[model samples]
Target: MNDLHAVNTILADHLRIVLVGTQHPGNIGAAARAMKTMGLSKLVLVAPEKAPDRDTLAMAAGADDLVERASVFASLAEAVADCRWVLGATARNRRIQLEPLHPRDAAQRALVAAAAGPVALVFGRERTGLNNAELQLCHAAVHIPSDPAFSSLNLAAAVQVLSYELRCALLGDAGSAGQSRTPPPTAEVAAHAELEGLFAQLADTLDQIDFHKGRAPDSAMRKLRRLYLRANLDSADVRLLRGVLADTQRMARIAGEASVDKKIR
Candidate 1:
């Protein structure tokens, strides 16, 4: 019990819960309440449709402090900009095959990431949930197992379930942990902001060469994002990839100019 308590305390510091495009202020308060119960205090809301009000405070019960301290962002990307690992809470399967993890399994993976840097668990809007673009930002998707007859879980309920699993994972009783094995050396994963910059550079380079060729670039970019995110690129990896993209762009521009000169000659 003592070991579990200590683990929970330390893990809490590295975990952050992000609510994206939240529609209800009450859900924010409820989520804060749930987080506090599970030893989590870092809460971020991205572009909430309704800011916290009197009802929100009332719903928070005794966890108003968490609600008060919660930071708000203008977008999902901005919310997780500094986080090294992002997990999206999604129940639906999209066209792209995202690695779907059960809540407990997700918690174990998240704990590993938290050991390296701040990790974010992102919950999408209450109505539509995370869109394709928002989900693309995440490295993986976490789904809470619910009865197929009535699987729809409330936003706050989903947060509570995931938080509970995380708490259990931290407590060292989660079955996902191996009993006897040497843990591998941890990698310093690049922050979301760095990955975002790399993605932008890649898009620009691809455009310069007309790689899309009238096809919708969103599909190709989304696939690329998922592929690289799964690779869990470290700082060195990001730098190397960005350098390649930069050189590609430079070469494309030079080739374009040479073609123009040849036409004139």
Candidate 2:
């Protein structure tokens, strides 16, 4: 079994910055600088209005390498397709059903998710912010705390704030060394293929009950998958869940047969 603490440490070093539909090249440059300060290097730009400019290079300062090697994508979906966990930065609360996490908390959770696969944090455009459709693509939303009365923050400032929090969380505070001496307990976690099979069984049962009659089944299933993935279920937990599902399906089948017999009688 892999050491859980070591796994978390490696994951912290492998985070990615994903900018979606960014309009200003300067903000992109500034974001790269902020990411570099936190030891993050991977960057993916999705459908930006302008490519990197001279002004951006000037603003980037010592982090020119990060900006120069940043990959550009034609769509947000393509940008985060390989990422196991995708987080979105948003100031205004859309009151969507998604769980809201602060930057530090998000980073910590992202570390755990990254242990299983790659992780990406998506920042929206400066003007209108992430639309509902774009937000749906992310697994979770992160909100930075600001003064309630006046909470407007510049795009680069937001990036800096999140990056700073991530750096601190990954590095920890003064007493962190003592805490790190004793590693956290590790559990056997479920594999991706096992989770996929569980989800398929659950979806089949839901379909039998017509739970998704009025809803988009694919979207609903995807949301359920996101929620389960966020839970980070261990192998034992997965088995327990699958057992419960099997019992539920058996009861449903028995109930259906009894109803049919009554109707015939």
lDDT of 1: 0.86
Per-residue lDDT over 96-184 for candidate 1, one digit per residue giving the tens place of the 0 to 100 score:
55777778778888898787778899999998899988888888788887888999999999999999988888876787743312131
Question: TM per model?
Answer: 0.93, 0.68
Q: Which residue ranges in model 1 land beyond 4 Å of their true spot?
A: 1-7, 177-185
Candidate 1 is scored at a TM of 0.93
Worst 10 residues of 2 by lDDT: 176-185
Q: Write the per-residue lDDT of candidate 2 for residues 1-265, one digit (tens) a residue.
A: 3574575457665578888888999988898998888777887899999999987888888888999999999987777765656788988877444567767677666665666666788889998778776776666788999999998887778888877766766665312222111121123545445565678798888887778877878678767866776676667887888898898888889989999999999
Clashing pairs in 2: none
Q: Which portions of model 2 show Cα errors greater than 4 Å?
A: 1-9, 174-226, 231-265
